[model samples]
Target: MNPALPLARLGRATLDALAAIGQVTLFALSALSHLVRPPFYLREFGQQVMQVGWFSLPVVGMTALFTGGALALQIYAGGARFNAEAVVPQIVAIGMARELGPVMAGLMVAARVASSIAAELGTMKVTEQIDALTTLSTHPVKYLAVPRLLAATLAMPVLVAVADAIGIMGGWLVGTTRLGFNSAAYLKNTTDFLQAWDIGSGLVKGAVFGFIVALMGCWFGMNSARGAQGVGRATKGAVVAASVLILAANYVLTELFFSA
Candidate 1:
């Protein structure tokens, strides 16, 4: 049990963590810089838009719908303790629009799209495809990372908007049928209490989360170790990192948007 050995291991871990962070930051900046330059790949971008955005609708919608319904039940139960059950509609709308909708949609996309991107790119890397692209004078970041990044960033807000609607609808269904509330009144309260900013803030969060998801996926994939195990690990790491970052970023964004 030598103190020097323990200290040495801790120092190495800290250095490794810092190094990883620096690498990811540089990678993100490089991708963003390339985004504004020439040779825009419309075909690749369109394919990514379909893959990262359109294909993600089902999972996002389902997640939001279930979350909204569960949230309504939970809020209703808690409000009942204080005879504040009528606050359900307002709470549900705000919660969904300002937080749950975007967060859930982001996490789902991370789970689905992030892993797919990581696996695709990781396989490409291990098979020397990325190197081949470089040999052909193709920039990997510009060709691979930029399109997915742009597609996710652009499409996430739309997905969150749709999720917000579906989520609110889920709350309405629960409030009306399960909670003994009137359908018209539930919808009215939801609309009346929700403001434009609530929706806007959530959409902004969607964009940020989308960027994080794609960036993490691409970063991990591009840096993945050789072999099947490495690709698997990269895919797993992308999902976990994206999900954690989404939650952390959500808290920060919430404070920025709503804190007094």
Candidate 2:
């Protein structure tokens, strides 16, 4: 390999990445600023709540249910090695509420809502609809991005709460039916072990993850290249970026909330 060529390529890649980061940061700040100074679009916000939140419930619920069930089985099997199988309820409750529930809901919403937003906006951009909005004196970021961002952030905590309940119920179903535990006992153990912080922390994580998801979608879509292929790429990139960011943010939030 030629040393000069490789060095040039590395430098180019670094610059491109930095440029992308700068662009995204500016876009995020713009959206945030639009969020407070309104011309508040309550109708758009309500539509997004339905699109992003209400439509997302089934997938989130199914994911939480299966994950909770599988987690129960895994934890039970693992705990049996140390004669601590009885810890299942408490562990499941904490595990789901503190981590899995928010994470799963966030990822699921990213997959669904992020892709939809990216595809829609990317299509609008390529079709010159965004320009039309601008020509009509509508700020694209305020008209398109801010409402979605606010809706997602507000709705995600509710989604996470539902996910938490469904997940714990899943573990309860497994514990009572498969693991030969009493229903009342399992419920009691779950409630007894859970504190306000565990659930609250997850909800907080949900809000952050939701913001990341919508932000990534809007940012990528706004910057998408022209044509169908560009729109497809933008949609895919939005989901991938949102998911990675969600997981990364989750770890950071977890450390802040739990690492005493």
Candidate 3:
């Protein structure tokens, strides 16, 4: 057993991870630099907005709604042991506004939008369309990546806001119907306990998550290998990377926003 082998493997993995991080950072910077350049693709931007935002609403809404309802039930059950069941509405609202709403929406968008972007761009790369665009004097990053990055970043906050509302409504519904709570009182408690900062923080998290999702997709897609298997791998990598980054970013943002 060569003791140096394990250390060597660890060092190699660390270097590989660092290199990947550097590459992604450079890719993101390149795409962002193209945002202010001329020949803006309004049509592409509009299509991406619709694709990433509007089409994502239903999934975001449903996820939030179910999560809120389940959260209320769990809180109520837990609070029962302490005779604090009356705190269900408040807790549900705070949880959804501060964490679940934005995180859930981000993961959902990462799964849907990130994979789609990666697959589409990977296909374009495989088919040489990206090269064709470059030959025609078009900057592929500007035409292909910038619109998606911009759209996702702008749309995520809106989706988080909508998710928060639906989630709170879900808690309200569950509280009033199943928990035998008064509707007016539940609504009042939810609104009274949820501060503007809570909602605002979640929206900000949403925006960051959205940017991360798009960035991962574009990076993987553009760097994908030259084959169908490579495109599939890129799509999978985009979703996985976006999801992990979303979770990691959520923790960082939560710490920054809520740490004393």
Candidate 4:
């Protein structure tokens, strides 16, 4: 009955989505452009480094530890059916490095940092502090997004490294204790299976995911609507979008790196 109207609305929705993506991309480029300019904000960069990297350590460590432990148990149990129990160490190492480590760390940072970015910038926007910066001839992109983006991009690789190490340790503990694996043998199996490429790919994933997460946060934050409700919306939207993007990106990266 309303075929024409529905088709028109569908076209508008597609256009709106495209526009949103374009806005976010433009905003990210603007921030990167500022990063190359003069009068660098070393203090802000240092502060964001602490916030994104140092402050994130505890959560990333614990997540990696528990995930690795669980992976060991699951692999051992699955392998018992075929008398392939010794595969636990290798599987755990590969899984954590190639898949879980970067994805989990990215999602966690998205939850933590994305929300904070949205709230902080949204508040500034609501209170006109952003406008004040504009009036003062200062670029907010430089002042806000550059530091956060650089911090996330640099910090995520470090965080993933810590996660990978701790995750392997967790698996080692579980393999030795619950799975009745000899510690030296377990370590050997892990080392024998994991190549440089596996770990390197994970670190690369970390950097890319970090950029996406921080970019989404800054984009949503800068474009967030006025007032508390708008800020809340931005926060929720950023986290949801970042998490989804991380998983989608992980799959793509995996295919690029490993698929024949």
Model 2 has an lDDT value of 0.94
Q: Which scores greater on lDDT, model 1 or model 3? A: 1
For model 4, how does the per-residue alpha-carbon lDDT over 119-222 read when each residue is reduced to its tens digit? 88888888888889999988889888898999899999998988898999999999898878999998998999999998999999999888888888888888
Model 4: per-residue Cα lDDT at residue 61: 91
Clashing residue pairs in candidate 1, if any? Answer: none
Clashes in candidate 1: how many? 0
Tell me the lDDT of candidate 1.
0.96
Clashes of each: 0, 0, 0, 0
Where is model 1 poorest over a 10-residue stretch in terms of lDDT? Answer: 183-192
lDDT for predicted candidate 3 compared with the true structure:
0.95
Tell me the TM-score of each prediction against the true structure: 0.99, 0.98, 0.97, 0.96
Q: Candidate 2 — which residues are off by over 4 angstroms?
A: none
Per-candidate RMSD vs. true structure? 0.8, 0.8, 1.1, 1.2
Q: Which one wins by TM-score: 3 or 4?
A: 3
Query: How does each model score on lDDT?
Result: 0.96, 0.94, 0.95, 0.90
lDDT of 2 by residue, 199-260 (tens): 99999999999999999999889888999999999999999999999999999999998998
